[model samples]
Target chain A: MTRDAIILAAIAGAGLLTVLLFAAGADGAPRAIAALLFLLIGPGLACVRLLRLDDPLTELALAVAVSLALETIVATALLATGSWSAGAALAALVAITLAAVAAGFARARGAGSPRA
Target chain B: MAAGVPGPARESAGQAVSSSPGPAALAMAWPVGRAPSWLLTLAPLLAALALWLAAIPAIDPDQMTDLGLIAVLPPAFYLALGLLILGFCALLGRERAGDWEPGAYIAAWIVILHGTPAIVYGSLRYAWAWKHVGIVDYIQRTGGIDPAIGYLPIYHNWPGFFGAAALLTEAAGLADALPLATWSPPFFELLFAAALLLVLRAVTGDRRLAWLGVWFFTLTNWVGQDYFSPQAITYALYLAAIGLCLWAFPARMPLAASPVGRVVIRGALLRRLAADFDRRAEWAGAASSALPDLSTVQRRGLLAMTLALLASIAVSHQLTPIVTILALFALVLLGQCRAWGLPLVMLLFTAGWMATGASSFAAEGIREVLSTLGRANENIDSNLIDASLFTPGFRIVSNAARALTAGVGLLATLGWLRRFHDGYLDLPLTLLWLAPVALLGMSSYGGEILFRVYFFALPAMAFFLAALFAPRSWRRGAASLIVVALASVVLAAGFLVAYYGHERSNYFRPGEIAAADYLARNAPAGSLIVEGSPNYPSRYHRYEQFVYVPLVAWPRGNVEASANAYSLADIEQMMADRHYAAAYLIITESQKVEMSVPGLASLEAIQGEIEASGDFAVLFRNDAATIYGLAGRQGAEP
Candidate 1:
C-alpha cells in the first residue's frame, strides 16, 4: 500500500476504534486492544516521521516518549488554566497527534523521501 | 570487533574476521547451515505462548491462598518459561543479530515473554494500582490536583501521568484505568526494549551488543517498576532523552589521546578538575561523534524538545528528575555532551518545581534529606525491611532479587576488568552508571529509592553488561554466544524473583474493589471506615469521604489504635472511644487468608466474635467480604 494510503487507513482505523470503544463503553479485551492502537497509532507514525531515525523500534520508542511528554504538557496546561476536562484533554491529544503527523509528513515530503 | 552475523562483520587491524573462521562461516562449519532460520528461533516463543494459553484455565483467584500468579498457572507455565529461555539461547546461539529483523523478532518474543502473566491475571494486583485509577478518576472529575500532604503527595503534586490516564480513559470512554494496568507490563516492556536498544547502540555503535543488551535487560529486570506507573513513562522518556542527546550532540573529547601517555583519574576532585583536554590528540584513532547528525537547526530543535521532555518529567515524578539532572551533568562533565546549559535548565526546572508546585510535599523532607546524607544502607534497609509482606517463598524471592542485583553488579565490575583486559577506556559511561547510586544519599523515597535507582541505572548498566561479550573483538564468536546466554539466564532468574516476589500483596480481588467502591459511594462524607487491615482497596477513590482506620496496620508503621481493636472483646471498648463514631468495618477474603496463613489473627474467631457481639451490626455482606457498622456506646450500655 502507498504511504499516504496507510496513514489515512490508520486514521480511519483510529476513528473506527474510537467509535467502537465508546460504543462498548465498559471493558472488553478486543476494544481494550483497539484502544491501545488508537491511542498510539497517530503518535507512533508522527514519531517515526519526526525522529528521522533508521530503526523502526527506536523510532516507535521515541514516539511513545514524545507523545507522553506532550500529553503531560497538555494536561498540565489544562490543569493550570482551569480548563481541564476529559473532553479538553482528548481534544488536545488529537490536535497534537494531527499536528505532529502533519509536520512529520511535511518534513518527509520536503526531504523528498520517507524512511518509515 | 567480535564478529556477529549480517554483512561481513567489522574486522580489527589486518586480522582474519573471526577467532574461528567467522560467525556465519563458523555456524555453517559447526552443526547449523549458514545460519538458523527465523522460524526456528520463533518456535520456542510460540510454544511458550501456547503453554501460557493452556495455563490460563487453571488460574483460580478464589483459592489464591498464600501463593499468587503462580497458583492459577499450571506446570505448562514452567514449560513456557523453559521455551522462552531456550528460544533466547537458540537465537543467540546461531551467532547472529546484526540486522533489525532479528531485533524485531526478539521484541516480538519479549511481548510474548512478558505478556503471559500480565494478560492471564484476573484483576489489578498492586495495592497502589487501584489508587492510581482513583487518582485518574479524581483528575477526570476535577482537573485540579487535591493536595495530599502525606501519602500520595508526589503523584498529586505532579499529576502528569495520572492526567494522561484520565484523558485516555475519557477518550476511550472506559470505566477506569483497569485495562491500562492489565496490559501495561508487556506494552511498556516492548517500548522499553526499543529505547534500551537505542541506548546500547549509542554507547557502543554495535547492533549486536545493543540487541544482546536489550535481551539481557529483559531477562534480568526483576524490578517491577514498569507496571502502569509514572516510572514506566519517565523511564521511556529518560532513554529517549539520552538517545536524542548522545545521537545528535555527542562531544568531541576522547578520554585517551596519548596511548603511551597514561592519565589516571582517581579521586572526585581530580575527576572534576581533570579537564586539560589533549589538543595534540587530533590523530587519535576514535572517530569523532562530535559532528551533528542532523542539520544545525534540526539538532537545536531536538535539544529544545528534549528540554521540554525534561520539564514534563520534572513535573511528573519526584525522583526521575533528580536522576535526569545527574545524567545530564555527567554527560556535560565527561565531554559526552556539548550543551552544559541543558543540565542547568533541568536543575532549575526541578528545583523550581519543588519550590513552587511541589512545595507542600517538600517541607516534610528538608531535614530528613539533610540528615541522611550518607546513610544509604539505613535508607535501603528502611524501604526493604519496613515494606516486606511475608508469603510462602518471600525469603527465596528476596534472596533471588539480591542475587540478581549482585550478579548485575558483578557483570558491570567485569566490564571494568574487561576494559583493563581489552585496553578500552571510557570512564564517563562508568560514571553515568554510578551516578544514580548517588540518589541513595537523597531521601529513601519511603524505602523505594533503591529500586528507583536500579531502574534509572539499568540502561547504563546494560551498556557495560554488553562489554562482557567480546562483541568488538569479532573473532570471539563462541565466547560471545556463551556469555550472552549466561547473562540472559541470570536476568531471567532475577525476573522470576522480582515478578513473583510480592504475589500475595500484589494480587487483589474484584470483591475487595467492590467493597472499597461501596464505601466510596455509600459511606457518608468524613465518616470513619475501618478495615481489618490496610490490604483492601480503600482510600484510592473518594479518599476524603471517610477516615480510613485499619484494625491492624501491618508492614507500614502505625499500629497505635489499630492494634488495640484486633478482637471482638476489644471492638466494644474500641467503639466507645471518642475516635470511633459511625464507623464501618470491612473484612475481605484476601484479608482472611492473610490473617490465617501468617497466623496474624484467627478469622474464624473474629467472625464468631462479631456474630456473638450486640454492639456491631452487619451493614453490607457478601460471600467474599463483609461490612459492619459499630453502634458505639449506645449498643454497649443497652
Candidate 2:
C-alpha cells in the first residue's frame, strides 16, 4: 500500500477500535474483562496512534480522544463499583463521546497542522 | 525573492492549499471607524454617573454622597496614579522610540480605567454579603460575631471600608448617593476590554491588533456577559501585572556597551540578567549618554506606583496568588534567574506580607478544595469514558457530533496560540494567557462564582484568539466566516448557558430587589426577622446592619444544619429576649426545596412549633419568594 493509504487505514482502524471499546464497556455484560478490555484497548490504542502519527492534527485528535476515553472508562468502572450513579456514568459517556468526536473532526480539518 | 509566477498559477496554488482566510484578512475586515475613541472611553462612565444621578430622586442626598465617594474615589485615584507612573516611566526612557501609538493606548487605557468602579462595587457586594449572610448564626453559635469575616477581611471586605470611609468622611452630610453597586457591572466590563488590548499590543506590537482585541473582548456577547462581575477586577489586576512584567522585563538584547556599563545600568539590564545570564547586554553608550537622570520626584512617583500596585494585589486576594504563580513561572521559563535565591526571597516576602492572608484564607477552604477536586475528578471520569469500539449508530453519531463541536473551541485556542507565536509573542506569556482555559475546565464549581474567577482569563483568551485569526492579507471574507463560526459556538455555549441555564435560575437571581422592596414597604414597624436562605439574605439585605434571623423550617419543618439555618433559632430567641415584634422568614424556590441530607427529620420537628405559634402569618408569596411574617411584629422604619 502507498503511504497515504497506510495512514488512512491506520486512522480507520484507530477510529474503529475506539468505538468498539466504548460499546463493550457500555454493554455491562461481563464486569471484569469488559472493564479490562476498555482500560487496555480504548485509551491504549489511541495513545499509541497519537504517539505514532506523523501529522499534527491527527496527533492532537488522538490525544484528545485518548483523554476522553480514559475519563469515560474510569468513570464507568467507578459507577459499576457503586462510587458513582448510573446517571453520572451516562453523562460521562456522552460528554466523552462528544469531546472525542469533536477532536477527531478538528484533526481532520487540519486545525493544528504542524507548520514546516 | 523569486519573481512572481503567473497570477493564475499562484492563485490556484493558494486555493489548493487552503480556502480559509488568514489572520491579516480578519483584522482589516472589521469596521474600523465604529465609535469615536473619546466617546468609547467616556460612554460607560457617563452612563453610570447619569444612573447614579437619576437615583438621587429616590435616595437621600447623604446616602448618595457616601455611595458616590466610596464607589468613585479609589478607581479615580488608581487611574491618576497609573498615569503618573506611565509619565515617570517615559521620562526614564527618553531615548526609547515612542513606538506605541498614543491613540490606541489611550483608547485601551480609557476602556480599562472606566471599569474600576464596577470592580470595586461587585467585590464590595460579594464581601459584604459574605460577612452578613450568616452573621446571626455565628452570633448564636459562637456567642458573638467573628470580626475577621472568616478570611482576610481587609482584601475581602474592601467595599465596606470604602462605604464606611465615605460615610465617615462626609460626617452624615446629606448628598445624593449613587447606586455604586449597580454601576459595577459595566465599569469592570470596560476594564476587561482594555486589558485585552494591552495583552494584544504586548503580543503583536501592533495598535490595530490591540484595537481588534478590544473589539473582540467587548463586542463579543460571550465575553461581555462574563466580564460583568467582581472576577473582572481580579482579571484586570492579573493583566496589569502581566503588562508591568512584560514592559519592565522585555526580551534580552545583545549589549554593545562594556560589561561594566551594563552592570552599572539598571532596569532592563537587571531584568535581562535576572531572566537569562547568557543574554548579552546591548546598550549603546551614545543612547546611555543622551539619557537624563530621572528627578527625585519622578523616582518617588515610580516608588509610589510600585507600592500602589502591590497594595492593589493585597486589596484583592482572589487572583493575586494565581497571578503570582503565573509571574513566577514566566520568569522561571524566561531563564532570568540563574539561582533560585531571588525567587525564594520574593516568595518569602510575598508569603510574609501579601500572600499570608490569602494563604490562610485558602487554607480555611482546604476541605472544600479537596471535595471540589474529588468531585471534579469524578465528573471528568464519568463524562469522558466509553466502552465500545462501535456504539448504537445513533449514539455513535451523536458522540461524534458533540466531540466535533467541542473540538472547534480547542481548535480556535490552538490557532490563537500559533498566531501568537508567529507574531513573536513570548511563549511563556502565552502560557499565562492560556491559564484561564485550564482554570475553567478544572474548577469544580458549577456556578457564576467559578465563572467570575474564569472572567479574568477571558481578556487573554479573546485577545489571543483575535490575534491568532487575524488575516495576513486583504482578502478577509474567508477569515470573517471562520470568526463567525467560532464566535457563534462560543456564544451558544458561554452566554446562552449562563443566561438560560444559570442566570435565570432562582438560585442566581433570587429576586433580591423585589424582596428588599417588599420588606421596605410592608413589614410592620421594628419587625424582628430571620432570613431562612443564606443565598437570599446575601442577595437582599445587609445581614450585618440588621438583626434578621437567617434560618427557617420547610413545608415539613426540615431543619438545615448550615450556619444560616442555626441563625433562625438564634433570631427567635433574640426576638423573645429583646421584646422584638415578629419574625420574618424569607424563602426562595432554591431554599424551600428538599436536599440530600439524611438527618433533616429533627429540623422538621421545629415546623410544628413555628406553625403552632399564633404570631406567624404568610406575609408574601410570589413565583420567586415567600415571606412569612410573625403577627403583631413591628417593622423598623429605615
Candidate 3:
C-alpha cells in the first residue's frame, strides 16, 4: 500500500481503538490504560504521517484534526456510558460527525490543496 | 567566476553544474516523526494535569472549586452557541455570493482563544456555589425541611438556580447529580471549543491556521484565569451571531423585471412576458456587475444566525447589551451597505428583541457603558505619560540610568500605543451606542454588580489583542514573546497581590476553617454566641450562630431588637435586658481605635464591671478573639 493509505489506516485504527476504550467505560484501570494508549499511539502515528508529507500546513491541519477527533471520541465514549444526558449526547454526535465529514472530504481532495 | 580566475567558473557556466544538497535540507530528511496524533493531542491535557498535580500540595480542592464556580460557564456556552450560529451564517454567505470567511475567522478566533482559559479557571474555582448558601438556609428555616424538595420559583440567584435545577433533575431520577457540578463547566468548555473550531475553519478556509489561532488564544493567562465570569458567555453569544450572519448571505439574487418594462408592455400577454424577461436580464446584468447576488438559503441562514445571536445574548448569565451592540455594528461594517443593508436591518430588530427579553438588571444595565468610557479615558491618559519619549531632565536623572532598557522600553511603548489605540476606538464606539442604558445602571449604584457590567469589554479586549498580535510568520515571534513575557509579569503581580496584599488576611484560611470546626463542635446547642463586632472575623464564624453585637450594643439585652430600634439608647437598654449564654469578643487592630472613643469606652467599662461582678467566666482567650461564658452556664443549657 502507498504511504498515504498506511497513514490513513493508522489514523482510522487509532480512532477505532479510542472508540472501543471509551465504550469499555472510563474509570479505574481500563479507562486509564485506554487513555495512555491513545495518548501515546495517536500522536505517534500522526507525527509519522506529518513527516512523510511535504507540506507543513497540511501536516499541521492533520495533526490538529487527529487531536480533535481523539478528544471527540473520548468525550463521546464518556457520554455513551450514560455519563451525559440524551441532549448532550446528541449534540456531541452532531458536532463530531460534521467536523469529521468536513475533514474527510478535505483530505480526499488531496493533501496540501490550496483552500478556495 | 571573476574574469581574472574564471577557468572553473567558465567550464561550469558552459556545462550547467548542480550544487550538492545543503545541511538544512539533509537535516529535514531525518526520521523525526515518531510521535503519534493522539499523543500530540493528549500532550497539553497531560501537561495541565501535571501542573495541577504539582500544585496540589499547596492548592486546596475547596478553594479551587470556589474559583471554578465563577469563571467557567459564560465563555464556554458563548463559544458553543457562536459555532452553531457561524455555520448558519456560512450557509447564508454561500447563498448571497459574499465572502463570509473574515467574519467567521474573527468570531472563531475570539471564542476558542478566550473560551478555553475561562473553562480552565472556572473548573479550578468552584466555591461560587456557596454564595447562595444563605438563601438555602433561609428556605430551610422557613419551610422546615430541605428547600430542594419544594419546586418553588427562585429569582436571579445563580446558586439557587443551580441548586433548584439539580434538585429537579434528581427528582426526575437522574443518577449522579453530584457529578453535574463538575460536568457542567467542562461540558460547556467542550461545546465552546467545538464551536470556535468550526467557525474558525469556515472563516479562515485554512483549518490549520484556525487551530493555531485557537491554541494561541487558549494559552493566554487571562483566558486561563478568568473563565468563570459572565463575559465568557457574552463572547460566545457574540461569536455565534457573527457566524449566523455569515451564513445569511444569498448565493445569488432573485431575478426580477423592471417596473418600466411591465408598464410599457401592457397589452399582448406574450409580448409583455418577453419584455419582462428582457428587463430582468438587464437588471441581473447590472446587479451582477455591481454586487454578487445571494441565494435564498444563504439569506435564511443569516437570518437564523442573527436570531441565534440575539437569543444567546438575551440568555447570557451576565447582561451584555453593550457587547451585543458592538457586534451588531461590526456586522454592519462587514456587510458594507447595499446587499448587507437588509441583514443590518434584521440584526437591529433582533437586538431590539433581545433588549426587551432580558429579565433581570434591565434598569441598571446602562452603567456598564458609561464606566467603560470612563476607564478608557483614564487608560489613554496613563498611556500618554508612559509612552512619552522625552522626560524632564530632573525627573529622568532622579530615576537613574535604569529608567529605560533598549529591548523592552521601545517595544513596551509600541505595545502600549497599540493597546491604547484599540481601546480608545472600541471604548468610544461601545459607549456611544450603550451610554444611555449604562447611565441607568449608574443611577442604581450597586458596587460590584456595576463593575461586572462594565467589564463586558474584556472579551472585546481579548479579541483586539488576538487581531493585533497573533503571528502569521516566524518574524512575528518577537512580538509573541514580548506579549507572553508581559502577560506573565502581570499574572505574577496579581498572584502577589492576592497572596500578600492588605486584604489577604481578610480571606478565609485553613486556620479559620479549623476555628469554625472547633466552634461547631464545642458550642452548646440553642445557645446564643455573640461576637464583639460585625466584621470579617465574625463572618469567618458564619457557620456558627455567632451574632456580632457592637460594644455599644452590650447595654441592650436584645441584639435584634436594638438593630430594629436603630437608637443607641434603645440598643444599650436591650443589651442590658437580654441574657446571653456566651459572648465571643474578637478584637482586631481596627476595633482598638473604637475602644478609645468615649461612648465605646463606657460600654467597655460596663463589660469590665460585669466581669468584676463575677457574672461571666472567660472560656477561651487569644490575641485575635476572646470568648466569655455566663458563670452559671452549663454545657446542657438551652
Candidate 4:
C-alpha cells in the first residue's frame, strides 16, 4: 500500500476501535491508549493528508497541533453552551473525523486515481 | 532555493552538491571507522539512558545544596550527558549521516536533559505546575468554567488548556492530571523540537544546521516555562504557526511592486541594512520559484490550519498571541512572508477573545496593565529575583544562567553579522529574534515578562548560534565539528547548573505532599489556609474550597517586602478574624528552603514560637512538614 493508503487505513481502524472501546465501557490502559492515538492523530491525519505534506516531522507536528486545536474548540464550545458531555464530545470528534476521511477518499477518487 | 543544501556557507565551502561527510570523517578513522553511523549515535544514547536510570535512585534530594540538583546528582549523570553531546557531534560530522541518526541523538539529549528531573522527582517539580493541575481538576469536577471565580480567575477566563486537559484526562480514565504534570517537560520539549524543525527547514535546507539549532535550543532553554502549563502548549503552537507561514507563504511580488517595498528599495543604506534577500535583483527569480508546489485547495487548507493554530494560541495564552502577531508582522514587513492578512486576523482573534471570554480579567486589570506600558526598566527588573539573597552556591548558579544567556546573545550577534557579510539577507531571522523584545515594554507579567521574552526569542537565537558551526571551507569541517562539540558541552554544563540548580526548593518531598493532601481532604469551604510561601504544592485539590494566604508577599519589584518577617502575634491576629469559620497554618521543608533568605523568619522559628504559645496545636506533623490549628477549634483537629 502507498503511504496515503496506510495512513487512511490506520485512521479508520483506530477510529473504529476507539468507538467500540467507548461503547464497551472499557476503562484501562488499552482504552486510554487507543483513545489517545485516535484523538491525537486520527482526525489530524484525515485533515492534513489532503495537504500532501510529505515530510514526516512537519506532517506529524501539524497533525498534533491541529488535533489539539480541534479538541480545544470542541470542548470549549460544548462547555460554553451548557451542554457538556465527554461522550458527546468524543462522538462529535469521531463524526468529524469520519466526515473528513470520506471527503479525502472522495477527493482522491475524483482525481481519477484511487492511489492518489 | 539553496538546492537542498544546508546553507550558503556550505555552498561556499565547495560541498553544496554532496551530503557526504567532509574531512571530519577521516579524523575519526582511528577510533570508530568500522561502526555504522546509526550505531555510533544510538550506542551512546542507549548507554546514557541506562546510566541515567541507574543514577536516578542514587540521587538524594536531601543532599542537594544551594547549587540545586547538580550538587546531589551522581557523576554518572554527567557522564551520560557528555556521551550524548559528543555522540551527536560525531554523528553530525560523519559520512552519509541521515536525519534519523542525528534526530535520535537530539531526542535522546532532550530525554536525558528534561527526563532526568521528571523521573527522579517523585512529585511534580514546580509549584506553578501543581497549580495548573488544580485548574484541570476544577474543570473536570465542575464540567464547566467559572470565569468570575475568586481563585485563579484568570485561568478560568482563559481555560482552553485546562478544558482540553480535562477531556483527555476523563477519556483516559485517569483520576487526576498529576501524571500529565509529571512528564510535561520532556513532552513539551519534544513538541518544541518538532515545531522548530518545520521553522528551520523552511528557512534553510541544511539538515546539519537545522539539527544543530534544535540541539542548541534544548541545551540553552533554561527558562523553565516548559512545565505543564498553557504557556507550553501555546508556545508550541506559536512555533508551528510561524514555521507553516514561512515554509508555504513566501511573498510573491517584488519589493518595487508594493508601496512599502518601494520606499524600502529607494533608500540605499536602509535597503542594505535590511538586506531582505527577496529584494535583491539576483535572488528574486529563485525566491519566487521556490514557493511550495501546492494546489489552490491545498493552499487554502493549509491557511485554514494556520489560522486554527493561531486561534488556539489566542484562546490559550495571554502573551503568545501578541508575540505571534508581532512575529507575523515582522515577517510580512521584511517580505519574508506573503500572509499580510495573518497579523490582522490574529489581532481580531486576540481582541475578540478578550472582549468575550477574557473580558473579566481584562476589565479588572486593564488599568494596571496600561500603567506598565513603556516601563521597560521596571518590567525587566521584575524578572530578576534578588540575587544577593541567594546562598553562595545559588549565586554562582544564577551567574552561570546569566553568562549562558549572554554567551548565546554574543554568539548570535556574530553569527548574524557573518551571515550578513556573506551576502545572505538574514533579515527575517534577525527580525524574528528581536520581535519578542517588544513585549518587554508592554507588561511585567508578575516579573516573568523578561523570561518569557527569552523563551520566545530562543528559536531564532538558536538558529544563529548554529550558523557559527556552518564551516567556511571543507578543510575547516573537522575544526568546525570540534568547535561545535565544545560549545555544546560548555552550554550543557551551564544548563545543568541553571536548570537543575534550583531543585533544592523546586523538588517536593512525599511528606510535604501528604500534608497538602491532608489539608485538601479535611479543610472546609471558606476556611483560611495560611502558608509560609507560595513555593510549595498547595492547590491541587479542592483549591477553591478555602482561601490561601501566604505570609511572604511578592508584590511587583519588591524583593525586600517578599522576605518579610512574620511573628506569632501577626499570625494570631490574622487567623483570629471572625469572618473565617476556621483557620490553619501549614509549613513545609520546601517552603523553608525557599524562604531561607535574609530578613525572613525561618519557618522553624515560627513553628517553635507557635508550639510555645500553647494557643495552637499541631494537627499533623512529619519530618518534612507540619500543619497547625487553633487549640479550641473543632474544625482544626485533623
lDDT of 2 by residue, B1-638 (tens): 11321111101012222233322222236574655533433333344344433433342211212112222233344334233223322211122212233233333333343343233323222222233223222222232222245332332322222222122111112111123333444544544444444444444443334444554454332322322222334445445445433433333333213233355547876756533322211111111121223344333332232233334343333344344554545444443212223234435534544333334444545444323222111112212324142223323332432343244346447756565333233443445655544455444444322433334444555555554554443122344435534553443333322221211111222354366557745555446556544334242233333345446433221122233445345545555544654456665543432211233333333444565665556677666565666555454222
Least accurate 10 contiguous residues by lDDT in model 2 chain B: B5-14
lDDT of 4 at A101: 79
By summed lDDT, the worst window of 10 consecutive residues in model 1 chain B runs over: B279-288
Q: What is the C-alpha lDDT profile of model 3 across B1-638, one tens digit per residue? A: 11232111101011211111211122336564765533432333344334433432342322322122222234333334333323322221121212233333333434333333333333222222222233333322232122122121111211222223222222223332222333333333433444444434333332323443343333222212132323343444444444333322312221122232334545577566554443432322222221223445434433543453454343333334444554455334322111354345545543543354221223334443233222111111111222233223212321221221121223333433453442212222222224323534443422323333323333233233333443333222334434433443343233222211211112333333333345555664334544343322232122324344555442222112224333434433433344544434333332332222233343344445545766556665444344555555454122
- What TM-score, over all chains together, does every model reach? 0.82, 0.46, 0.41, 0.91
True-vs-predicted CA distance for residue B47, candidate 3, Å: 4.8
Every candidate's DockQ is: 0.45, 0.01, 0.04, 0.57
Alpha carbon lDDT at B352, candidate 3: 49
> Which has the better DockQ: candidate 1, or candidate 2?
1
Interface CA RMSD, all predictions? 3.4, 25.8, 13.0, 2.1
Please, what are the lDDT tens digits per residue for candidate 1 over residues A1-116? Answer: 54654664575456456655655565656655665566665554554456554456655666677767777877877765557876666565666566666675566557755432
Best by DockQ: 4
| Chain B TM, every candidate | 0.81, 0.52, 0.44, 0.90
Query: What overall lDDT goes with each candidate model?
Result: 0.62, 0.37, 0.34, 0.75
Which scores greater on DockQ, model 3 or model 4? 4
Give a tens-digit lDDT track for model 1, residues B1-638.
22322223323233334343223343546676444555544655667777878876776655543434545556887677666655554454344434544565566556655665565556776655666777876776666776553445556777788877777777766677877777777877877887776665555544555566777677766677667777777777777787777766666464432221235565666544343333211211132222325665556656766886788888777667888889988777666767768889989988887787667767667554233222122112322652244454554556666777777878877876664345444444665688899988866445556666776777767666766754555445656655565666667656665565456656666767677777777765546666776655666666644566666554434221355366676665555555533567788866665454353565667777887776677777777688877654332211
Residue B363 CA displacement from its true place in model 3, Å: 8.8
For model 1, report DockQ: 0.45
lDDT of 3 at B313: 43
Q: lDDT per residue, candidate 3, A30-114, as tens digits?
A: 4434433343234423432433334333233334333323332333233223243322332343344344434444555566532
